[model samples]
Structures are given as C-alpha cells and as structure tokens.
Target chain A: MRNSKMASHLSHFTHKTSFFTSNPRRPSPPCMSVVLSTAPTQSYWASIDAQIDAYLNKSIPIRSPESVFEPMHHLTFAAPRTTAASLCVAACEPAIHLMHAAAYTHEHLPLTDRPRPRPGIQHKYNPNIELLTGDGIIPFGLELLARSLDPARSNPDKILRVIVEITRATGSQGMVDGQYQELGLDQLGSEYDVIEYVCKKKEGELHACGAACGAILGGGAEEEIESLRRFGLYAGMVQGIQGKNKAGFMEEKIEKFKELALKELESLQGKKTELISSLVEPSLAAVQIS
Target chain B: MRNSKMASHLSHFTHKTSFFTSNPRRPSPPCMSVVLSTAPTQSYWASIDAQIDAYLNKSIPIRSPESVFEPMHHLTFAAPRTTAASLCVAACEPAIHLMHAAAYTHEHLPLTDRPRPRPGIQHKYNPNIELLTGDGIIPFGLELLARSLDPARSNPDKILRVIVEITRATGSQGMVDGQYQELGLDQLGSEYDVIEYVCKKKEGELHACGAACGAILGGGAEEEIESLRRFGLYAGMVQGIQGKNKAGFMEEKIEKFKELALKELESLQGKKTELISSLVEPSLAAVQIS
Candidate 1:
C-alpha cells in the first residue's frame, strides 16, 4: 500500500483518477487494472476521510478552554513531585540535563533554563540571533515570558529573546526533551516524535492546570483556542520566513493582518467614514459640477 | 530509511541490521564501520558524555505545562460575560454535542468494542457496528467506568450494567478501534517503531478532548485516570486476544495502571498506618516492586 501511494499520486494527476491505461497489453502492475478501475475514488475519499476522521475523532482537545488539558494535567502532576526537591542532590541530572538540553534545543520540547547547559546554541535566521542557555535560569521560559509580559520590559527586545529561544528549540540547534511528551502521549512513538508531539500535549496541560500556575501559564481555554489558530499561523509564517514558498509566506501573515485591519475598520466610525468618503466623493463632485 | 525498515521487519532477524549495510565494494553506511571497529569503552563513554553535553546545552521547553499552554490563563477571564444569551441557546447544544461526541468517542476508542465507527465509524469494537451515542452507553467494557461514575444512580447493578456496556466496547465482537505501540530498544532495530501503529485519530469522534473528558465522564480526576487506563488496557487486551503479542498488549496499560494505582495507593496511605490492606496493598506492592 505504501509503495503504490507515491506512484498513485503522480498517476492520479495524469490519468484524472485512473492510474494505468485500461489496455491489456500495457506494462502495468498486476493489480493495476483493479486499482485503476475501482479504487481511485474510493481510496481518495478514504484517505480524505481518514485524515478528517483523525481530526474529528483522534486529535486531542487542543483548543478547548475548559478541562482541556485534564489528561495532561495528570501527566504533569505525574512529573516527579520530587523534581523540585531532588534538583540539587541528583546526578540523575544528566538525564534531566539531557531533557532540559533537548527541550532548549528542540521544538515543542518541555525543559526549563534554570539548569542551563552552556552559554550559547546556534546561528540561524540571521534575521535574529538566538542562543541556548544550558541551565534553566530562564526556567521553563518563565524568565522569557516574564520579560515579555512584564510592563516594564520591552516588547521587541523580549520578543527578540523569545525569538532566539524559539528558534533554538525549533531548529536542529536545540535539544528536545521528549520523555515528558512520552508521558503525555502514553509513550506512543519514537523519542523524537514524543517531543514533537509534545506540542499538542503541552497545549493540553496548560489548559488543564489553571491557578497561579494557570495565571502564569495561561491555560485558559479560549487562549488555547487562539493558540490553535496561532500555531497554524506561526507554522505558515515560519515556513514562509524559511523562503520555502514566498507566495505562501507573504499571503499568510499579510492575510491575517488584513483581516485584523478590516475588523478594526468595521468597528470604528472614523474608519467607516473614511471608506464611505472614497465611495461618495465622486457623487459629491458630480453634484458640485451640476 | 522506511524501505530498509519495512524490508527488515517483513524478512528475518539475520538480515535485520545488515538491511542497511552497503555492499563491501560499495561505500559502507557509517554504521557498518562501527560494527567492525569497536571503540574503546572509555571513548564510548567520552563520546556519550560529549553527546550529552551537546544535547543538554541546546535544550528548551516549547510544549510542556511550563511552555505553551499554561501561561495564558490570566487572559481567559477578562471578558467574563457571555453577551448574547440567544447565541448560547442556538450554539450550546451543538457545542455540548461536539464535546460529548469528542469526549465519549475518544474514551470509547480505548474500549474493547474499540472501532466505534458509525455513520462511517466503527463505533463499537465489532465489525459493522456503528457509533451513535455520546454518554458512553456503548460497550460493556467502558460502561464499567460510566456506570461506576454516573451520579444519577450508583447502584451496583447499574455499575455492573455499565461494565457490561464496557464489555461490549471490547471483545472480538466489539469496537476494535485499531491500535499503536512502540517496541523496546533492545528488541528494536534501526529506528524505533510503532509495533502496530494503529491510527486512533482515524477511528471515531474521540479526540484527546476525550482523554480529559474521561475525568468528567468518570466523575473526577482520579476516576478519569482509571477510566482511561481501563479503556486503554481493555482495548489492548482485545487486540492481543485477537492474536497480537500478549506482552505487547499489556505494555501500554501496565505503566498507565501502575501510575494511577500508585497514586491511589499513595493517597490511600494518607498520614496513618491505615494500611487498609485492599487499597494499601497495591501501593505497597508498587513501592516495593517498582
């Protein structure tokens, strides 16, 4: 099934849903006749339904506001309660250190900066320079979030820091702490995927445990919902920024900004007046001429 | 990578690692040279240390409770009022339905009658069975958790009825929502694996929203955890009963049950020597054995 999929994708474009010529003499696959004649629409629809079904059924509560992260909440609490107490007296810090390192280096990994590994990480997106701090002094991005959320702190400056931290974690330069994600996914896949998928779980956790923790973490469900949209936007933006597809990139954020602008304009009487002015001005000019 | 892997698995153990090996005359994969030239144990340790160093210095948290989701809690409650009550009337039922479907289906996916698709859902574990309800009234296996928690009436018979429902979710004639599992490292070759990577997301209306919803459906965090574990275990057991590896079947749920059981055991111990043999035994066994 896997082997045939790639060829089928190509053939689908050429044959308009038929993979092989219907002629008996054609050098097609043994079962190609059956597949071409009967399977195209069914398989196509099946695949679409599979993905949709996965989304509708299997994906976890990513954007939900209330009780969204409850499953993850159990997992997070499962985080060795002794983690805080055992921090100093442990050589197991190597594993913990590895987790932190991976968290800082990889994307969607869970690690804090209090246990910084070394001084710096990598260079990417010359657009901004972000480095890794081995220890978690920044501690679970607390320091970073603080830098951003604090009124006294500078937005662009702190965002710049977050930018660097984020880049480090996302790109190859960062380490990914997947064990936690494994805990979240019930240890479903490769350690690598654990952290990658942790993105989904972390999103769940924040929504589950709200308190000063929630206040600090912002596990509010609506915000999580926004995050769902935000992630799609962020990924698109990152891809575009990577110069993967300039058109896709430009339209992505631009369209989002345009939407916000339009919404704002609709809400404001002044903006409405300005828009109507342009439309009504020609009539006014004609009336003056008359 | 995938080709080599699938070939190796489908073939035999003798050809396993060498599946990726190059012809002696052809350029050998880097791994082959290491296979022949064993490194000094000290240097192996050194290299591991270096890798650890490199890995640690680069880690960051992106998706843990500490990273993505929890930080947004403060912002959720600012606009506490739902302005349009009429909107609630029109939207609430569907929203609840979506939640119920998502939560119930997600919960149901782990039942014995696993593939609860109806209206295109396996719905209940049995082949051709359709998924139609929200309250988890389906399957005898999952009904155990439901009836265990249903506040309307918690009679033993009701609980037993619920268990009976849950049993319907499991077994050969039930849901069989499909599955996913990772092989252990020693037992692994090349990349890690999904011993049987069933896609639950493609199964039914159960998204992760159900994982957390299990807590509510089961009536609390503690019970919800049990509900999830019981469901995962029962589904896995069904898969095994269907003739997959018995050990593999228990693998996913063992840790899950252990974790929950241990926590329960801990709380059960409380501050006293109240080692209520029934509750304390599990915890004591876990403490001693684990």
Candidate 2:
C-alpha cells in the first residue's frame, strides 16, 4: 500500500518523463535528486512513509539480505541532476529509487573501495554527483521540478524550452501546476489529515477561478461561456465520485459523476446555435486602428 | 512517500530496467511493495492481497477507465501527436515488464484514438495509480532481476554466478554449502519472509562446491589452493550476516561469523607462506591449488 502508493505517483512521473527522455529535449538527467537520512526504527514497515519522505528531506532504509547485519554502509547522496536527465532519469526512476533507499539504509559494511567515513549517517555516496543540502527540505525535489520545467528561465534554455513547448501544452494554469498543489495537502491520512480539508477548499477556489478564466478566455461569448460553466458543473459532479474516499461524496458518488457528465453534454448541445451566433457576431468597436 | 516506495520495489525488478530505476542489487523493494498493499492488521491486508491477485489474474470492476474515459484522448491522438513520426519506442527486458504492468493497470484515455470504454472506472480520478485490489502485485519484476543477473555468469565468472560458483568456491565436502545455507534464511523481511531460509541452504552447498571449483581453476599449487579457501571463508562470513537478522546475534551466531572470518584470513596467510616455499624448494610438487 505504501510502496504501491509510490508507484502510483511515480507512474505519472514516468509518462511525463518518457516524453522528455526520448525527445532529447533536456539535459541527460532531468531528475531533481534529493536525499535525506533518519534514525533506525523498531518496525521497518511502519516507518516506510517517513523513510520515503526522507528522499527529499531525511534518511530512509533499504532492507537487503545483508542490510540487517554487517549492513552495507550508507551511500545516500544529493545531486543537481538536470531536468532533461531527470526525465530520462524518470524513465528509470524506479531503479534509482531502489538504490537510493539501499544507499541510505545499509550502514555497517562500507564498500572496500570508498574512503569516506561518517558513522551511522548516510551521506552523498555516489562519485558522479554534485550534491547540496540546504537548511532543510523546504525546496527539495519540487524546486528542481519547477526550475527544470520553466522554459523562459531554463539554465540550458533551449532544451527545457522544448520540453515544455512540446508535451506540456497544458499552458499556464492547467493540470501541471494544479496537480502539484493538490498533492501537497492531499496527504489526508497521515499526520496531515488537515491537509485534505485545506485541499478541498483550495480546489473549490480553483473551480471558481477556472470558470471565470474560461469565460474570459472565450471573450465573453455568452453561449460559449455558458458551455464552460456547464463543464465546471459537470466536473464537480464527476469529482463527487472521487470525493467518496475523502469526505466529499455522501450518497451517489458514481451516479452523480455520470449525471453531471451527461448534463454538461446535453447543455452544450442545446446551446450550439447560440454559441455559433456569438462566434459570428462582434461587439461594437470603440476605435478603428487603421 | 507512496510513489517513492513503489519505485523502490519496482526497481528491485531490475531485469534490464534503466540503470537509473531498478536494481536487484537492492532487494528491499519487493518486500516494501508488498508491505504497502497489505496491512499490519494481517487479516484485512491479506484479503486485500487476494483481491489484487485475483485482479492480476483477470480484469475487474467490469467498467474500467481505459475503455470508458480515455481522458487524454485529445493529447494522445489529436493535433500534435497525430503522425507516427512523432512517437518513439524502446526495447529492453523491463520494456516487457513495463508493458505488462501497463496492460494490467492502464485504464483508457486514448491509446490510438479508439473507443475502449470502461463502464465507470476513471483511471486518473486521482493523480496517482489506483490499487485495483489491495493485495495485487506484478511478479515479473523479480524474474527480470534474476535473468539479467546470473551470479554464476559475470565478467569474471567466479564472482558472477549466484549460488553455483560461490558453492564451488567453498569445497566439495559441502561444508561451505552448509555455511551459506544458514545465512540464506535470514534475508530481509517480507510476506514471504522465510524464502531466505531456502536460499541459505542452497547457498551453503554452492559455497563448498564453489571453493572446490575455484581450486580447480587455480593451477595445482598449494599456495593458490590455500588462497581460494581463504576467499571462500571471507565470502561465507559476509553471507552469515544474513542469517543473523532472523535468529539474531545469539552467542552461537556471533561465534560462528567471527570464527569463519578469522579462518579465511588464516588460509590467505598460509597461501602467502606456500608461495614463498615454492621459491625456496625448486621441485615442490605444486601440492595445492586455490
């Protein structure tokens, strides 16, 4: 469950990563590698979440055949991997993650070749890495993700520019940023149950904002604007189904999702002619540029 | 945390995944992954596992997301991605692993602009992958690791082979094999916690056999044979660490591991003396080979 949870999150990452990996649009290792360490625990299973979160801010354990005793020495390291490389790295992210956990957790037997000595703590262990640990994990992997994806300010501007311009055509306020914010407060089950409530509130604001923006983007064409409104209603209905696991949907989660979807389609079809009329008719112009 | 965990386990699948993603070299993932889907409660988690296993064998939730939603339809088959030239593909062992997981888990938005409908399942309802059933897991990842890494067959075949060469390096009398067997049982924790025990028995046999084989590989020289014995002992001590995790460091376990390491060193030193003797005694009938 905990581990699979990682897979679920990572699977999305792989898709986003594949686009960049095969495209050759960014640096070779686009991933933002973040490594952290923590103290050992009595129950390896229970501490899994803390272990995982440590990838960006603390330490984690890598259980291995030799890990329990005569454990391999901690080999965790943080590095500035390029976004292009990170994406390419994302394709193989699962593998890197395993070694990352291993490199951090194994702590008794240092490889004969390595010369570093830090007892009980996993350090930046890889030779081919340039790592930095800040005051904390405030920025972590997210910092890398943001920087790597920014086209206008890309370090190697052209490569990152292409990555965004090509696959991430969601434009400014679509799924990319929206998704990141959702992940933040969505850790509802652990210590941050409050995050779920906050997320729901934020989501509501986003919906309202989305409706206004869509209408504006459509130039206030009444019918088209209405269609956008219908879509929002429809989305809310669909979302109700998703909210069941949380606290959103009470009775008809699935049914509501269906009803909303159908209603939106019907509403859109009904307003087809009006939308066309709006598309053709123009409001009076205040001044002529010519 | 969840995504990292999944990536961690999946990485253990190795079997030709990008070096950045997986490594059987770190076996923690499989165990961690299972831990995620199952629960500490034991009963509930077990049932969840069964459900997932069933899903693994056959499709469920009759209406799935793939055939129904095809959420990314516009991006997948629309304007920019229309032509085949725009797509890229890869081939590797984990390539199949990836394909299998996708085949089982992927629910539709669009594969090729076709109507694959799921009655209700929205694969991307959450930003993460859904656990169709609580307990289900993909087994191929482990197989991939084994096929790719045949310990019996590495660059220097001696160290490459898993149990075979290692056993042979130990001795023909099976003494070395027994030692490895003890350690194999003590591998990392998992639902299949005791598999290590079985592996340990085999490893013991392998070591004894491996040492004997190693001796043959060495020329018929007393010094070389002694060195091979020492190597086997060192390897055995390293392996014994695995066993300690289970039975723990009982006095016997501590004594055995320590004694074995010392014995290995003793053999190495003996080899050094034999090499010197060979130089002094011209016709010393190369009595031992490592």
Candidate 3:
C-alpha cells in the first residue's frame, strides 16, 4: 500500500514538465566549455531538487531512533545545495533509473575525499560532510533504492546487479582505491602521473559509474551500456580536474569526452537512444561547470 | 578473466573441510550457555580465516596505486579471529554463500561502536579497523555475491532481490537505524526501555539481518526465511542483554528463540531444506554465546 503511494508521489515529480524550463540568462564565465550550453537552466536545477526531495520523501522513513537516522538525514537532507546522488537522480528522471543513478553517485562520493579547507587549520571541517566513517552515504542510497521500487514488480536480480556495479565502482577496486592513492600525496609532492591517476580513480570513477548505471537500468543494449560506461569514465576524468590553472587542459579533455559520449549515444539508434541522449547532453553541460 | 580466477580461488577454500574440527574441553566459565554445546570448534574458526583470506586474495587487486587498496588490505586481511560474514559462509560451507555472509557481517561492525576499555583514556585506538571510507564492507559483499554462483544459470532478478534484502538489512531501516537509536544515549541517562531499544537495534538487528541473508541466499522457503528472521530477532534481543547479572534471563530468551528457529526449520520437509538446516542450527548455537 505504502509502495503504491510512494510510486505515485514520485510519478507526480517526474511528469511535471514545468520543471524542465531551461534558463538562458544566467551569467557564464569565460572558461566555460561548449558543454555548458547557453545560460544555466534554473528549471533543470529545480528538477534536480524536486527529484531529490521526492526521492528522499518516498524513500527514507522518518521515525523514531533519531540517533542512527539523524546523521544520515543531516548528511543528505540538511545539505545546503546539490549532492552527487541528487545529480545522479535528476539526470535520470524516474523510478528505477533514478535510484540506480543516485546509488552509484552517492556510493562513490566520500566525505573524506575533499581537500582540507583552510591553511594552518588542524581540524578541517566540511559542513556538507557529516562523518569520515565508511561508505556513510551508501546505506542511505541502498535504503532509497530498496524502498523506491515495488518488490512485486521489480526484478531482484537486476537490483542486485546494480548493487554489484555501484559497489565495485565505489569499492577498493574502484573509487576508494583512488582515494587511498591520493591520501598523503601532498606530503610526497604530486607528480603529473600520480595526479592523473588519482583524478581518474577518485573523482572520475563515480561519475562514470553513475552514467553507466543510468544506461544499465534504462534498459540500454549491451553495446550502449558499454559506451555509456566509457563516456562516464572520460567525463568523470574531466570533472575531477579542479585546479584553476588546469582550466584550459580540463576544457580540452572535457570536449574530448563530450564528443566521445555523444558518439557512444549515437550507437543506440532508437527512441531509447534519444532519451539517453537527453540525459547525456545536460550531464556534459554540468561537467563544464563541475 | 580476473572474475573467473576469483571464482576458482574461492572454491578452493569452501571445498576444504579440514577446517571444521571442534575442540572440546576448552575452558568455560559458569555463565557459559548450554548453547555453547560440548566443545569449541577451533578448526571452524580457522576455516573462517582461510575463507576470508581466499576472498581477499582473489578480490582485491594489488597493483599500482598502492595507496587505494592498501588500507582495505589492512582492514580485511589483518583482522584476527572469525567475522560474522565468514561464520555465515562457513556455516553454509560453500563458495557463493561464503561471500554474501562475510560481506553483510563486515559492513555493520562499525569501529566507533566499541566501548572504552580504560576509564580515563581520551583516545582509544583500534588497529583492526581502517577507514577505506564509504560503506567499506559492502563492496566486498557485493563482489562476493556477484562472484558467487554462475551468471549463466542464475536469474538476475533473484540476484537483485538478494542485494535489496542485504542492503536493506544493513541500511538505516535495518542496522544503521538501530545504531541511530543508540547514538548519544550514553549522554542521556539510560532508561530501561531506551536500553532495550538500543540493544535490539544496535546488536540484535545485524544478527537478525545476517540470519535472514543466509536464509534468503541459501534458498530457504518464504516461511523458513520468516522463521529464521524471527529467530534471529529474538536471539539478537537475548544477545543484546549484556550484563552478566542478566545472564539467566538472557539464557531463557536465547533458548526460546533457538526453539522457535528450529521449529521454523522443521517446516521445510524436503532435501533442499536439509542444506538450509545445516546453516541455521550452528547459527542458533552461536547466538547463545554471542
């Protein structure tokens, strides 16, 4: 009974076309890549928030035992702006696709991965991050995924596959592995190869994984899934490069990945491909400003 | 390629039964429950270690980017004694079951949950836990579940179902939710109701969830799974009663739960059930001493 209510609540958010109005008047900095497109779409951003609000409302059960859930709520719900999970969910508008995308994005976005904020500050605090504890965001994501879908209709095996994919993408073999590499690198002094390696593993891995999740859950063909996986990987690589000095280089790499992602989307050759293109186009745009 | 190799290595651990010899005549205090049975099983414990070693050896890729995987290696490979996941796997005594069992156990055993050993110590350090960060243990379980059984023959839907079950079991609604109830309670004066709630949520929830995982993964009937889940919950409730002064009550509760669990197992009257019974009996036995 609750499941149907939850689905209905989510359906309302997904179907509201008023949420898709793209804004053309927002200011753009000179370094913004072509992927950014023409003005920032306030509605697209609103859709992201709406999607997250609906996802959380329908997913996380707010009840007693405030201790366990409070941290998660604070970490996810109390955040000021957007989260990777929200971005992932918004990119894939509805239901199963939203969940897999959010889970993948949330799984890889570590609280401890951010740079220390201030000089000479022994304790670096990020309001956005609640704890450095292990995979804190994932349980929230998993809970959302589990609750968001109706068990009677959804395939459990596909759910497990999504879990496996997200876990692997965020696990020791994927994103965490990258964080491990970068942990004390400042003390060791960063080399170009090491920096690139860190960027690929830590930053790029989640984005790539999120993109692939959408592809897989959206019922893309095997070839399409593979292509999106590659697209996500390259796009993530570009997003991970954050230094202001690296803007030119980042733009160059972003364009390369953008072209690659577009080319991959072209392989599907159907309405499904068209829907996926819709997801990828904005994702590419977000990457320019990411 | 690596996937296939991983499957083979795991098979080697599960096939070796030399690890199950029980050692009787081990020292037991007067408070030790009858559920402890006649003897201590040293070999079974060894089997747990061996299984985890095989799992870690096969799953973690130790190559360049030593930074990423090393922390995971240390946390998983260096741990002493048997873990819940391993016990879960060992009880099943099979390769596929081994992975999911171990993974679920490892995910919820948070490092911060420990009570301070010294009265006045400001910082109590546990070497066993290394924060690879972000639901560190889940990936291992997901990997194990993913690698367990064959993709060719198994239903993807069923696999997904297992993932959903396990994730829910460990997520806020299951384990973390319990933890949330317990958090900061020490600061507040411990009320009896609060204590019981905390105990149920923090300690019992995972055990109950673990039992359910094994049941679901082992192919137990819906009734059997419900029975085991109830059995686990009751057993966990009993186990959560920590003070030695409450030992007698705890024993009675444990016995009641064990009987209930056994009755649930009895409901399955077929050859397939025999396999599940093997897994549950020892699990019930372990709960007495848990």
Candidate 4:
C-alpha cells in the first residue's frame, strides 16, 4: 500500500517538465542571477536546468521498491541547484547532478545515532532509508552515463574517460577523503593549508570533475578540458572556503581563488564562458546571504 | 598522525600476496571444499582468488587520505569470501568483488545510532566511517572496471555493457531494493512469492551480473552469457532463501533452485561446469553451520 502511494508520487515528480517551470508552490530558482544581469546567460542556465530535468525524468525508471526510488527522486529533484551540476556542458548535467545528489546525501548523513535537524529529504525520511537511497543513487548516475555511450554517435573512449574522472573525483582520494579528514578537524587544527587541502578534496574536486566532464562531452580539446578543470577547481575552492569560514574572514583567499578561476578560463578565449564565469561570484554572495 | 598510521596499515594490507595464500594467522579456506573434493576444482578456485588479489593489489593505488582508503581496503580484502566473486570467469573478479564488498558493507550497517556487534570490518570501525567507506568503495569498484577498458586489447562496447549490468544489478531495483523491502518485512509478510522476488532482486541479480560479466569479459557469445546469467540467478536465489529461513525449513525450496540452477547450464553442455556447478551446494552447508 505504502509502495503504491510512493510510486504514484514518484511518477508525478518525474513527469514534471522542469524544477523551474513556474510552479507557484515551489520556490523560485535559488542561486542563479545573483551577480549577473545578462539575459543570455540566464537563458543558457535555464536550458541546462531543463536538460537535466528532462534527462532525469526519462532515465530514472519508476519500478518496484518505490521506497528507495521515491527518496532518490525527491532528494535529487527537490534540492536547490548546486554549482556542481550547473557547471557541466552538454548532456553531462544529469549524470553530474545525480553524482552530486549522491554526494550531498552522504555528506549530510548524521555522524551520531541522533538524526540531525536538517531540511530537505533527510529531514523527511529516516536515516537508514536515506543511506540506502544514496547507495542506490550513485549507480543510477553511473548507469545514466554508461547508457549514453554510443559507438556511432559519440566517442566511447571519451565516455570511458569521463567515467574514470567522475569516479576518481568522488572516490577515496577525493570527496570521501575530504569528508574523512573533516571528522578529525579538531586534532588537525585550523591551518589554512589543511583547510584548503580538505576543501579542495571535498568540494573543489567535484566541481573540477563537473567542468572537466562538460568539456569532455562538449568535444573540447585536451588543453581546453584541462583548463576548464582548473577553472572548476579554483571556483569550487572559493565555495569551500566560504562554507568553512565566515563570509568576511575568507575574502582575501576567496578573491585569490576567484581570480585563479578566471585566469584558467583565459585559455578558452573564443568559447562562451559568461555562464561559467558567473558560477564563481555567486558562491561568495550565497555564502554572504546565509 | 592517525592518518599516517592508517596509511602504513593500508600499505601492509595491499601488499599481501593473496587472501588464501596460507597465512598461518588467517583461518583456512572456509567453504570451497564443502561438497566438491576434486583437486582440479580446488586449484581453479585458488587461481581465481589469486587473480582477484593481484588485481586489487595492482589497481588499488596507495594515496593520500588514508582514513577512507584504510577502511575500504580492510573491508574489501579482509572479508570472508562470498560465492559472488568466485563465480566470475576471468578478469571481472576484482571488479565484481569490489561491487560485492560495497553491497556487503551497506547491508550490514546498523539502522539505529547504537552500533551492531558484527564481525569483520564494521566491528572495528564506527558506523559513520563505515558508511562513508561504503560510499567510497562503489566508485573504486567502478574505477577498476573502467580502467580495464583498453580498446586495443578488449571490447569497449562490452565493457560498457558490463558496467550497465553491474550498476543495474546493484541499483535501486536490485540489492538495495531487497534491503529496503526487508525493512518492512512485517508488512510484506512471509509469502513465498514475495520472498522469492526480494531474494532474486537482492542476491540473484548480483550473482547474475557477476556471471554475465565473466562471460562478457571472456568474449563469450550472447547466448552463453545469458545462459550463465540464468544459472547464477538460480544459484543466488538458493543462497538468498537459505539466508532468510532456517536450514530445515527451506530445504525443499533450496533443492528446487539448485536443480533450476543446474538446468540453466544445460545449453553450455560443452563448457566446463565443475567449478560453476559447485557454487550452489555450499550455501546449504553454510546456512546449516550458522
């Protein structure tokens, strides 16, 4: 009975055209346009958002055990946009978004037995369900990317490379490692280097992964992929630093990273980077607002 | 300091030759000889174990953030053998083992804040670390498989198919779904059909995935892969049922699955069946021992 009800809700959620499709009950687009006034950039971002939503709707098949799928759909679709998914180019957005949603789910898991008072999906569901839902989501994301591989239409090797990139970014050496280090932050102390390293691994690498995947999927040159990867790394660092420290305290460090991010974009001279360039500033504003 | 210690331990663990290489400190091989007494079969199983061990040692590179890697290595290499990994034919063992290890880690997680007293990796680590470790392990497994895709040596298309197979088997409709449904077992009741569906989804699909991957890696024909897949599904269902019910209560059902498992292998009459066919009986003995 419960399964059937959840399945119906899941169908409805997946059928919704886009998260930003003027649903009065839903909150307006959260973080885009905070610093930019360009209409073209806004439309580009909206297009990417719609692409992600459409891909998710088609890919996440409604099946048995709605208990797990329901939470995965809810957590993924209902969450506000992170810089992670928006940074991607081409069809990589949905795959990257799924990966981000998985990471977000695990990152927010309660360290203790007591459930943390958090908003969004975790707040509504029990921790066990959330944990399993996360376990399920990662593979679903990988499946989406794997399914996109076509010998005639796209470079299978590039898709393989993207898989390796995404996995490495999220694996032990990347995001998970950063999260582990955070558990012992007290013992490690508050050195800038330590914080930076952790922040890069936890947050920067994922953003870096998204940007690199975007370039890879977009058929960018090797140099372009590497440049965008660095751009994402620095941009993610700004977000990470802001997240760790108060807005004013890390302004100098944040500015340094923001400049570094723009510097990396210099190599992609002819490419349209207004949307990408706009990704870094919003982090600062978002941190300030919170 | 703690990170350094863990890194040292991780190095020692990864450098070990083989899990079954007669470590006096370790228990002898547990269930390999339970039913089959053939010396050749024992040697075949040993070789597969060594291959998996070699793959792990070579592929799992030692890097920074030892906290997460340490637990991942520990959980993966130190766990007792499951029928899942042993059933694979060729180089897919390591990849499948990693996936199985990830599933095993999630399966044993304590639902409440209070830790469950279990053996192996979880017994040593806190639930939070264990949870994060599981999250890291899945991608590591996928990385191993993706890293194996050398277009010069193997079929990239087949590798992609295997990736889809694995992700699908372990995704929401597979093992995680089984776990989720088990959480509501009271409402689900003890109907044979319900139990069979859950068991097949949880255990059977993974086993099916392993067998199919092995066949795919070996460049077996499509029909051969499908046949081996069915064989694995039936064998895994026997194990699943035995796991849920007492030894005596499900013997009849277990026998039915055992026969079904053997029947699926009928199409591959020319192929060697000794090692594959031997996988089914041990589950019965294993369940009885517990």
- Top lDDT hit: 4
User: What lDDT tens digits, residue by residue, belong to model 2 across residues B1-290?
Assistant: 12233233334322321211234354321111221211223332234334333322222122222322132221121111100010001101121222223222322322222224345543443212121110011112211222232232212221112112221222111322232223342344652333334333333333333343334322224554444444444333335334445545344543554456345445544232232122112233243423
Q: Which ranges in model 4 have alpha carbons more than 4 Å from their true place? A: A1-38, A111-115, A118-122, A150-152, A185-191, A281-290, B1-39, B61-63, B113-115, B118-122, B191-194, B281-290
Which parts of model 3 are misplaced by more than 4 Å? A9-42, A78-129, A132-136, A146-157, A185-195, A242-290, B1-49, B78-87, B90-129, B147-149, B178-183, B186-196, B236-290
Which tens-of-lDDT digit does each residue in A210-265 have in candidate 1? Answer: 11121112122344324322332233222222332343434554455334423332
RMSD of 2: 26.9
RMSD of each: 27.9, 26.9, 10.0, 9.9
lDDT of each: 0.24, 0.27, 0.45, 0.67
Best by DockQ: 4
Candidates 1 onward: DockQ, in order? 0.01, 0.01, 0.26, 0.42
**Model 4 lDDT per residue over B105-179, tens place:** 766776554345545534567767777788888887887667664333445667677888888888887888877
Chain B TM-score for all candidates, comma-separated: 0.21, 0.25, 0.60, 0.76
Maximum-TM-score candidate: 4
The ten-residue window of minimal lDDT in model 4 chain B covers B28-37
2 or 3, greater by lDDT: 3
